[model samples]
Every structure is written in C-alpha cells, then in structure tokens.
Target: MKRTVLAIDIGSTKICALIAEIDDDNNAQIIGAGIAKAQGLRKGSITNIELASKSIKSALNDAKRVAGTELRSAIVTISGAYTKSLNSSGIVNIPNKEITLNEIQRVMHTSLYNANIPNEFEVLHALPYNFKVDDQDFIEDPLGMNAARLEVETHIITTQKSNLNNLRKAVKAAGVEVESVVLSGYASAIAVLNADEKELGAAVVDMGGNTSNIVIHSGHAIRYNDFLGVGSNHITNDLSMALHTPLHTADNVKITYGSLYAPSNDLIELPVIGDETSSHEVSLEVVHNVIYARVEETLMIIAQSIEKSGLKEHMGAGVVLTGGFTKIEGLRELAVAILDNMPVRLAKPTDVGGLFDTLRDPSYSGAVGLIKYLADGYTAYEIDVNRRMRHAGEESATHTGSLPEEAPKFEPIAPASSTPTSAAPTPPVKDEKIAESATMVNIGSNKPVQDDQPNPISKFWNWATQLF
Candidate 1:
C-alpha cells in the first residue's frame, strides 16, 4: 500500500501544509496543499499561541479536505535569528582495532558534548560533515575499516528549547502531531537542490516576511547556517515611509510598481491619502527606489553570510532563491547583480498528484520538500528491510555484521501448487540456491536508479521528469 506524509512550513508570513504520497518509483506525489497568512509570528519566532494555533488548524483542515483523509502527524519547518551554527570536532578510540558502525556513532556522540546550552536550548540536528579513521580522512562511512582511532567533524544546529516547546504545543492544539522539525532553508534544499549542487556547494536562501533563513551545503553536507532579521516586510515599511502613504495603500502600490531595475522614463504615480483618495501622484521612480533599496540590503546580508562560510570561491552551483517575496518582479535580476556572477535561479516544487496545478509556486518549496524528504526516508527503510530478509534466508550468508549477507532469502512456507504434474519439482536447497549464489552480484545495485541532473534545467522540471 502507498504511504502518505504531511509537511508543514511555519514561516514568518505564512503557514503552508502539503500532503504527499510516495509512488513505487520513489517519487513524492503531492495530494494536497494549504497556505494561510501567518499571525502571531514575528521575525520567524512564535509570539502568540492563540493566533498561531488558529493558523495551523486552518491550514491542516484545508489539507485534510483535499487529501480526503485525516492527517495526524506532519514534518514542520523552523527558523529564527537566534539559531546559531558551529563546526565541532570529535574523536573516539576504537578498542576493537576495527572502526565499526558503533564506533563511528560513539565518535559522533562525543563531538556534540557541549555544556554551554543554558538549559533553555537543545540540539535540533547534528550532521556529520566528514569522518576519519586513523590518519585517513573524508570517509563517508567508516564501518569495517581497520583503524584504532575514529574521528568526525559535525555541524551542530541548536534552537531554543522553549521556542520549540511552544511550537509543539501550538501544533498539538491544532489537532495534529509534529513528526519532526526541519530548518526552513534545509527543507527548501531538500526539495529544490540536486545531488551535484549539494556536492559542489550551494547556498539556499528562504526569503520570508520578516526573516531570511540561510543554509550552506558542500560535498552533500551542510557546513553553516544563519538567519538574517530582514525580509519583504522591510520593503513594505520603506514604501510606507517614502511615499507618506498608509501601510495598506503603500503595500498595494509597492506590489504594483516595484522594480529592482531603474526605469528610463522614471515616471510613477500613487494616490495620496485623503478623502475619497484625492488625486495625488507619486513618482514611479521614488517607489521603485524605495523597494529596490531594501531588497538590495537583504541580498547584501545574504552575500555576507556566504562569504563568512569561507566557501564563496568553492560554490559550484551558486545560489538558489525561494519564498513568497521572490515572486515579485525583477528580484531575480537583482539577485544576480548581488551574487557575484554565480548562477542564480528561482526554485519551485514539483511532482504532485492532486491540486498540483495550483501548488507550483516557489513559495511552497519548503512544504513540498518536507514531503519529498519524508518519502525518501521511508523508501530507504523499506529497501533495508528487504535486504535483511534476503540475508537471513541465504545458505552462504556471511556472519559478519556488515550489512545482511543475501538480501533476505525466502523459503517456501506453503505446500505445492494445486496443478498436477507427472514429476514433482524438487525444492532448491544448498548449492542449488540461485538467490544465495547471485547475492553478491546485485547486492549494492538495489537502490532506485537516479539519472544525472543538468544545471541549466530548472529544478521543478528535474523533479517532475525524474520520477518517470
């Protein structure tokens, strides 16, 4: 039976919900999606439980309606300016002479031992960036390797425990369960980034209402993360101040006339705030300048973050931009100007089943990516189970704990078929076991095949066509 997953992104300006299913081909197909204007959130931090609960409940209901099934649990997104990232090193002595999985796990655990978390913060994710055994380095997996010392460098991500608990309470009160919490920028990366980009190093920027979440990845590992306390809300405020217009009217005018590029005519007009909207015109040039200035500032902040990662020169995939604010006109061009000639592109989620036609916007990337990650994690577990079964049933199964021997060989648990035959077919045993003998030939080839992804092709297209 097909399995279903729910993904939610609790952003500064919106709460998005996505319901998806994994197909036999290992693709995430979206079955439903919901988006609600955010409330009780400031700078990516929950401020009011009542308002946040309402938003969560409304989005969950919308998703359930479209899914035709009730969802009890969901993966949610979290972002805040207070979140910090650091690279820590860990080492462990392998008493058994050989670096085993347990030894690696121990080294990883030791690397994250920090007594500085003020009792109000907890680690959200501990990502192992690289592993080393003895003197060898960059080992992705260290199992079965001959070494006396195992070492690992990990990226530790922590969030305020108080904030997490509040988010948990709000989600639970909305009649849903929180399966896991993922960083907003990381969630976007899971949905839009391909393996090569991840391997070559890229920065994912999630521009939201009041916060921009940044995550850095290189060699398929996250190296740094940071959040800047600025977003499209700054732009709106700038317009409100520059035009001397009310907040509502200023927002509308900015959306209608905002542009990152300067106009040759430099002519613009906006209604003056008076009785019945009296005839008053503001220069389009003024509106454009105000919006562009704030956007440039946001991009500059992101650029500085990239430089601080010490990976500005090694970024092979460049920058990927996603969020509701990215939908504004001329943002891509502005991004290109600020990103130092790197390849800049907007990413959107794809490969949904129901209501997919309406969920193609870049703003939904986080929720969609959460669904895809959940599906991939589930598929990996199923494959592992089948492998174990094959190993246990094989006649020549190796006793070594390094993976199952024969991918879980099967035995006949039932009597012969009802069809009568002149001669009874002998049940294969010992050396006659084809599955046992051929296990080594295809053991490592069981993973679902994924073809190459080209850089020029949009991420959405890559996601949509890869499933086939």
Candidate 2:
C-alpha cells in the first residue's frame, strides 16, 4: 500500500501543511505543501472555531491540490501560552526475570499512574527520559534484558483541556480529522537539532512570532520546558509605537531592516509605506535600538528561565536556536551576549528527503519535524488508514494483553509497484524466511544499511510516539 502522511503545523500567525509519501522501506519523502494566513487564534489557542475551521480547510485544499491526492486526516501541531510541563517517576517489580515488551508497557503506565495533572489540564505527552533496572542506572532499553525491578522517569506535558478540545474541533470542522497533537517545541527540536547537540546536552529555543518555546535537554532527553509569552510580535509593537507608524508598517520595517545586536549610529531615510512621498530621514541606528530593546528583553527572560532549569550548568553544547524570529539578523549575537556560559547557533530542519529545498525556513521546522516524528514512529503494526481507524487500533492495543514488537528485518520493501500487487503471486515460503533473517542491503554497494539516529533516541521516540 502507498502510505501518505499529512502533517499540519498550526501557529498564531499561519498554518502550514506538508504531505509526504511513506515508502515500503519506511522512508518518507515530501510530496506536497500548503501555507495560509492563520485566523481565529490568538497566541496559539483558538478563540473563533468557525474562522479557524475555514483557515484549516483552505490550507489543506491547497495542499491536496499540489499533492494531487486528498487526505482526510492530519497529524497537527499545537502550542500556546497555556501549555505546561513537569517531571514524574514510577517504580515496579518485575514478575519475570527477563523484561518483556508487555512488562515495559506496564511499568511505563505505572509511572504516570499517580501523575497529578491539574483538573483543567490534559496530558499531551509523557516522554520517558530515564530508565533503571534494579541497581543499574540509565538503562536505555531493558526489554529482553534481565532485571528484577524497574524504575522510570518521564517528562509529562499538559495543556488546558478546553483549549485542546477547541483546537481539535476546529481541525475536525475543516473536514480533516486530527491524527495526533504534538507539542510545538519537541517537534521543532526533532527537525533542527543534530544527534550530537541532543546527546551532549543543549537547549533549543524556538522564538516564534507570538511565543518563544524553551526546552532544556540533558542525558539524551528533554528535562525541562518553558514558554515565554513575549515574542517577535512584541518587538514589532515596540517598533510601531516608537516610530509613530502603523503595525503593518512597523512589521515591514522589522523584516526589511531589523537588527538586534548592531550599532544604531548609522543614519538612513525611510518613507513610511503609506507616506512614500514624504520620506523621513531616520538612522538605521534608531531602527536598531527599538528592535534591540525588545529582543534583548526577550532573550534575558529566556536566559533566566534556563538558569532556573539548573540545566544551564550542564549545557556544554550551548544553545541551538530556530523558528521564524531567529531569522532576525544578529539575534544569535544578542543571545551570545546574554548567555555567556555557552555559544548560541542558528539552525533549521536538515536531513529531510524530497522537499528539503522548499521547506527550508526555520518557520517550517515544526511542520517538517512532525513528519520525521511520525515517520520514525512508523512500524509494521500501524495501518495507513483514517483517523477513526487509527483510534480503534490504539484502543484495541490498550485493551489487548501485549504490546507491539520491534520492527523485524524484512525483504527490502519491494519497489513501489506500478500495478496492483494485492493479489500478486506469493513469494516462495523459503524466500520469506531468508528475507526475515537477512540484513537489508543497499542495491549498488551491497552493504547493510542501519539507522543513523543513536539507538537510544530511536527507542524512546518509538515508545513516546505510540504512547502519546
């Protein structure tokens, strides 16, 4: 079957849709995209469902037109000032000497058993960061390993229940069912950060238009998360008021000539867009000051939050920054000035196949990473079906006794057939057994291919994607 995944990124300013085809080998290639001005949402949460629904449907229709295929379900991204996160731990005794997949599931469930989510909040994700087997610490995957007792620590994310429902309803109203909701910060990290940055302990700051999301990671998992209400839009407002110009005019000034860490001593002339005939002689210096002030304030608040995380001391890998606001020239320079302990670098989504060149903006990081997230979670067990079908499978898994097994080696997913193969002749029974035990080989070089992600990240993302 040809599997397609529609990933949507919903922000206060815009909505982005990316569609990719998942091939037999489980590799995903981008095939289509849609971007539309966002509506009915303020600072990431929906206020007007009807308008939001219209915006979503418009974006998806554009994406479907480009893809030449209609998809009814999408895995969407959601964020807001309303989001919250915390850490929790759980312990359990193993009945068997060796751990089994089912036992792993049971312990993970026990970890969240007493997690005290607030009444108005609902769990978005419970990501396991650490695992212990008896006296041994930091056991990444204990399955098939001998252990008497198991312990786990998880990072739990939650958002307002009402907000989640309204967003879900808005997407459903658009005629596209919501497949799953991922926290915007984690999705951005998946798209931008490299394995070394993640494993060596680095903080990723996604500075979007209406909100800036800060995540601290150490020991190969996200340890802390913080959301800042002020963002680039705040800077635009400051510019607007300082220059006596309209908001749209200020936004244009920021995009055209904004600088965060530059000297404002230089002079220039800028005619307000509406009053082009009456040009105002202004120093780039004045524009620089207005932008620098707000951006610096935002950066300082983020640095303080990092200090509070206490992961600041361990951030030897420094900071990796992304999101549209990061595009502002000299933002990294300002960040470097504020965060003296480590260097700050700009990043965007990398290593994605197919539509890599088109989805190059840091703004698209969340959407692209969501594809990687969903693709990495792909297994033989999941069906390429609609939202209702997927929900049923998940419900059945919860009610069933056993958890799904790890991916087994199979014959190189045969080339996507040009003709219907559903009723094609079956392969020889012996060939099937050989394929199961064989290492996947590259066609040209005949070398076995393996996943590039450090095994630990792959395992955790696998479990977390399914669990959420």
Candidate 3:
C-alpha cells in the first residue's frame, strides 16, 4: 500500500537527491531532498572515483538525515551525449482472441529484439507509445480489447554500457541498489507536460550543465529524443573567454547578468572580481549578443535534430523547458525569436506534492520526475557491459610487470631409511622464505595505479559522460 523511492539526478555542476513516499491513494510526495556540489567529474562522467563517491555519499547522507532512514534502492536519472534513441515496432498474433498484459510486455521486448546496437551500447528504456489492435489504430492500451493481431510502436533509449556501469558502481558503493536509470530529459517531459500538451504535440529541451536534451512528445509518447554535448556550461565558458575572466567569476556574472533577450540600449558598469576598486563596464547589447549566439546555436541544433525525426512541424503545443539554465531572464523571448515565434514555457516538476516549495524549482525537475516514472509501473532495460573492452585499471592488473605465482606447498620427504627409495629428498626449502615470497606476490596483485599518471579507463569513461 505504501512505497519509498529515492531518485537522484547526477549532473556536471551539481547532484540532486530526492526521497519520495508513494501510495495509490495519495499518488506521490517528496519527503526529503538534498543538493551537493559535484567534484571529480566532467560533462557528467566520474573522473575521480573517490571524489565522486564522496559527493554522492554526502548528498545521500543529507537526504537520509531528512527522511530519517537509509535508502536501499534508488531510481536514478542519467543523461549524457552517450544516450541514444530509436523507434521500433513489433507485431504479435492474438491467439487467445483478446489482448492481455502479457502480450504488451512481449511486444515491447520484441521491439528490443529488433534493436540493432553494438556491444558497447545498452538499452535503458523500451517504452511503448502507440498501439494498434487489428482495425483499431492509435490505441494506447489494447488490453481487454478483442483483436486478432496486436502491434505496438516503442521508443527505445540506450546509452554506452561502460558509462552506465561506472555510474552504477559509484552509486552502489554508497550502499544503494541502482534500481532504474531513466533518461533525465524523458523524466522532465513526463513531469512537466500535461495531457493537452502531449495530445497536441510538444517538445521539452532540458538544458543542464553539460548536456541539453531534446525530447519531442506527440500522441502522448516520446516521438524524438537526442542530446547536445554542449549546454549552459559552454555558454559560461564562452563568457569566461570573451570577457577575460576566471571561470568561477564568469559563472556568477552569467547567472547575474545573462539574458537571451535584448534589454534597454544602455551600458552598466559593474565591479570586476579579483580587484578592489576597478570596475568593468560592458554594453548590455554585447552581453545579450554573446548569450544569444550560443543559445541560438543550441536551439538550431535541436531544430535540425527534430527536423531529421520529422517532428519539427508537429510541435503544436510548442516547446517547454526544464533545467537550471531556463532561469535566465528573457530566455523565453530569445527562444521565440530564434524558433520562428514558437510558444515556449518554463516548467518544473508537477502533479506531485510534499516539500512542494523546495522542489518547485526548474532545476529539480529531472530528479523529481524520476519518482513519478518509477511509481507509475515501468521497466528498466539494463545495459550489459560485462564483456566490454577492459578498463585501464583492470588491464593494468595483468600487465603490471609479471607477478610471481605462489610457490606450491611441499612436505618434508621421509628419510631414505637405508632403502635408497627416493634419491634422499633434497633439504626442504625454508618456510619463512616461501611465506615472504607469497606476501610479495599478494602485494603486487593489489597494487593501485598511481594518481599522478593518466588513466586510460577514465579516458574511455569521459568520452561518453555527456549524458542527460
């Protein structure tokens, strides 16, 4: 009758952990939420295992303290450039003269069977969207409907196997089972979009620190999904370079003065950081110009991706945005200017209660959305990266200068006893010497890679870390 689910949205800039309690009668409610600064990570990938683990543990502990309990399993949110999407259809015969839940599950799996992905890739979600029952089409649920044939269309979300494995490993190290990994963009869409918007077709472009995801919703299902490797972080970096300022300073300035829309034609001088008296004055026009250019490029790329999916023309409900970057002033105006005056609305997680004021921020959309996703009865398709290319640390274990095998144990041979039976066994080797040799082997086997050296494992991990 009651269930608890922990949802975490791991990002390049910060990590958001949410604890929720759900009941059939009450729907869902957020009981605890925690935020922590992310470290040892770049573009959503864990670069330093120790740092990442600590960051996650810190956030987890804060939420646990608020909830008054420890979470054993979590439904986490994952997003990166490595996240991929494709549409697949499956057909199954209805021999029982009626469709059932079993058939629905079968068809979804069938769609997965039709997916063509390399070993490095793993399917994360196989979500059924449109269903057809014989002559009845556009059916979302065909159960209990008499039909001879049942066919369903599914949207498949996948990511690099190794990338997922590393994230799961980090989370598991904090004593939580990685229950389900959902695409953050999809979760945002689920939480933000209403039935009318979904029916008419809409798009959710979740702009985060390192990845901005585009998920097109039409006919109440995911129509198109993709991610831009660059996001608001790129905008910050551009500001830092163009204005000749430190990254942290630029980040703060952008948050304070950044706007995608144009303002009055005037210049305002502001005190520059790292200086006691000197002030820097820049044209508001110039500021908006920089912000506009980067955001426009991002929007254009999203437009092109949607066009490729053939969903660009069908966005009748227009675009809804959810993420930290959406807080920028005049972003909606700028989006309309570049998107042909299309409607745009900023949204946060909706249709849930508890700790309402805190979780209402657009930044918490993905983390909160995950709770709704898991509570609504969904399946998580795990990626199988067990056979993936060996990680650098594991590979180094075998190549770290050959370790001597432990010498076989031996017993002292009986004296020949004047029978000349076994060539008078040689003097037994010293027990202490053998024991010392075994210890050396054991130490070598556990040797860790030097921290100063480059890690090939993280190199591969970083390549696909641009997730949702």
Candidate 4:
C-alpha cells in the first residue's frame, strides 16, 4: 500500500512535524518537515492552551506547505510531566499442550488487566518485554511449541486524560487526528538505540528545552521509564540569573559558549547586542561551570532512576543521549563524566530512505521514530490470529475437517474518543478490532533518583537478572 503518515513531535522547546510515505515494500521515506518554537508549555505540560495550539498550528502548516498535501491525521510524540510507567506480567496455560497465537494474545492481555489506573488516565503503550513459555525464556514467538504454561512480562506507560485530550484538541483544531501518541523517550530510543543495545539493556535520555525524559530498556524492551523536571531551560535560567542578563542573552550565550568542562584563566570577549562602545568579557570557565552544574545534577538524577529500576548497573549497551539539549557543545563528554562506567554517545536518527539528510539531525529523533513505528506494520493484536491458526493446524493433525471456520478477522478501529463532553464519555473500548491494536503500558513509578553511573556490564546483568 502507498501510505502517507504525518508525525508530530510536540516538545517543550519546539513543535516538529513530518510527512512521510510508506512504500509497498514498507520503507518509510520522509517527504516533508517543519519546526516551530514552542510557547506556553513547560516541561512537557500545557500551561496555555491557546499558545500551545498556535505553536502546533504553525508547525502543521509548515509541514503542509512542504508536503504540498493536506493531512488528516498524525502520529504524535508525548513526554514530560504527567507521564508514568510500570511493569506487569501475564500468564496463560497452553491450551491442549499446543502453543497458539490466540493463547499468546490471551496471556498478554491477562498481563495488561493488572495495570489499574484512575479513569482520568489512559494507557499510551504496553510493550512486551519478552515471553517465557514453560521455563524457556526470551521466546520471541511461540506459535507451535509444546508448553504447559506461558508467562509474559510487559511495560506499560500512561498519561493524564486531560493532557492527552488537550493535545488531541489542538491537533484536531489544526485539522488532524492523532493516529497515535508515543512517549518522546520511547521514540528517541527507537531512533537511536540499536538491536544489541536494546537486547543487552540501555538507557536513553532526551534533553529538550524544558524537560528531560529518561527511558530504561532491558532485555531488548522498556523495563523502567521516567522523566526529569529540569532540562536545558534550567541551565539557561541559571545563566540569566548569574550574569544578570536577559533570557535572550542567556540563550545566545549558552549556544555560543556552553560547555561541561572549561579551563581556568580562560577569558573570551564579545560585543553585547545594543551596547555602546564596550565589549563584554567573560571566562569560558564561568560558562562551563554553569553548564556543567545543571547537566551533571540532571544526569545524576537520571542515573539514580536507573539504579532504582535496578537496571543501572546492567546497562551493557551504555547510554544514548538525544533531543535538542544534546546539541550543547561538550555535552556528550559531560554525559560520559557523570554517567561513570558506561559508554556514552549522542544519538541521531538514521536509515530513512528519502530526504534523509534533513531527518538525520538529533532534533528530529522523535519524528523519525514515530514514522519508523508506523512503517513497521505489526500491530499487537496480530498474535490472536497467528495463535488461532497454529492451534487449528495442530488440531487438524488429529482430526481432518479443514480446521474449524471459527478463526476471527482483524480490522482497525478509531481510538476511543478522549474528548471531554458535557457528560463523562470515556469508556473502556470493547470492540475487538481496537483490541487487536491495543497496547498497554504501565505507569508505576514516579521519576527515579541514581547516584553516579556504573559499569555497562553491570547495568546489563542487572536487567538480565530481572527478566527471569
């Protein structure tokens, strides 16, 4: 199918939009893109609906202009405050000692049922960490195996219903349906972390303008997730306060001279805008100290979160840093210093087929990941049909009758409306079609707190032990 998808990344610093086409071969190629400065949003929370809407509209219009096509829906990236995560498990007895896709689906669903939350919150994602069939672990697929019982572990993420609704309303007002809302940290991981890193366990920290999202993946799946309330914005604020300068000047100074490590006796001079005949002088060390302090503290909290998840010591793949904040000069070095034992690198989006150059920037990681996910083509619900087929085929081995005609059909359904009405209307969607694509994420922990980073192998081992 020749499909086109619009992906939007709404961040505290900026709003980015991308339009991509999925070829019959399932390759997603970026065709258009747009970015606009954000307003009235703080640390991923909407503070002013009108201003946020304007920011979104600007980005959407820019994308429309670039694509030269009208868009009706978009896949969005969500993060920051109000987002939460959890770990849940599901168990199902293998029916008749034959593993079937239906059975697998049932077991997975059983796990999701345990993610209880208030009615005001909605699940954004329920990712399968891995599966264990009768003591055999890490079985990616178990359609035809003979197992007495199946156990599955998954990670669930959810956000406040009102927050999501506000986002949806803004998109709708801009004439687009939110096809899906993915967490920014998760989206960044999709773009940056490789298969091995995911398998061995890794952490991704996306530092945006007003927030930093921390996601921990172990066993090639997301096990722990959280976000820091501070981001680059805090650094800028610190600069403004310390230098007695306006925010605009502080931002410019940060971009121009920010560093995590600076040398003493280092002085640089520059002309202050609108100033008379005097040039302002400042030491690079001063700038570096300010930048280093905030960066290190934030990273420390992220490290602490990983430790609490107990996966910090086991991250064999190390740390992957993405988002706008990563653009700061020497930030990668800063990450390495604070993280302690794990390898640290800046992550940028790679592998898109067309107009790829534009999407390669770290800033666009969320948009790229959202597109990659849409192009992957596998929905969580496909397990049922696969299981049913496997079960029927096994049943046919004993008795011939063309397998019962009871296999079900799968279809796509619109996401249940989160729109608030005059009356309460959000209900648990019972439609099977929606169920097939329905993914549940857990919102269990608040932001985590770790001390210093640890060895990568230790991080991996920690996750490895947790999987069982």
How does model 1 score by TM-score?
A: 0.76
lDDT of 2 by residue, 109-212 (tens): 55555577789987777667788999888786676788766777877778888988998999999998887888788788878877687778889888888888
Error of 1 at 302 (Å): 1.4
What's the best-to-worst order under TM-score?
2, 4, 3, 1
How does each model score on lDDT? 0.68, 0.72, 0.69, 0.70
Worst 10 residues of 3 by lDDT: 383-392
> What is the alpha-carbon RMSD of candidate 2 to the true structure?
14.8
**Model 1 lDDT tens row, 396-418:** 12232432232222221122342
lDDT order, best first, reads 2, 4, 3, 1
- Evaluated at residue 442, the lDDT of candidate 3 is 34
| Per-residue lDDT over 1-468 for candidate 4, one digit per residue giving the tens place of the 0 to 100 score | 688889999888889888899876668878888888988677777778788878888998988898888888788887757977677887765434667555565565566666675788777777776788899888866767887677888777778889888888777776788777778887888877887887787898887778888888777667788888877889889887766566787888898777555556667665554563566777777777888888888888877877778887668889998877888877777667777867997888767877557678787887788887667622232221111211223323223123222122111111124222422221112222223222221111112223365445556766777897
lDDT top scorer = 2
Off-target runs (Cα >4 Å) in candidate 3 are 264-283, 377-468
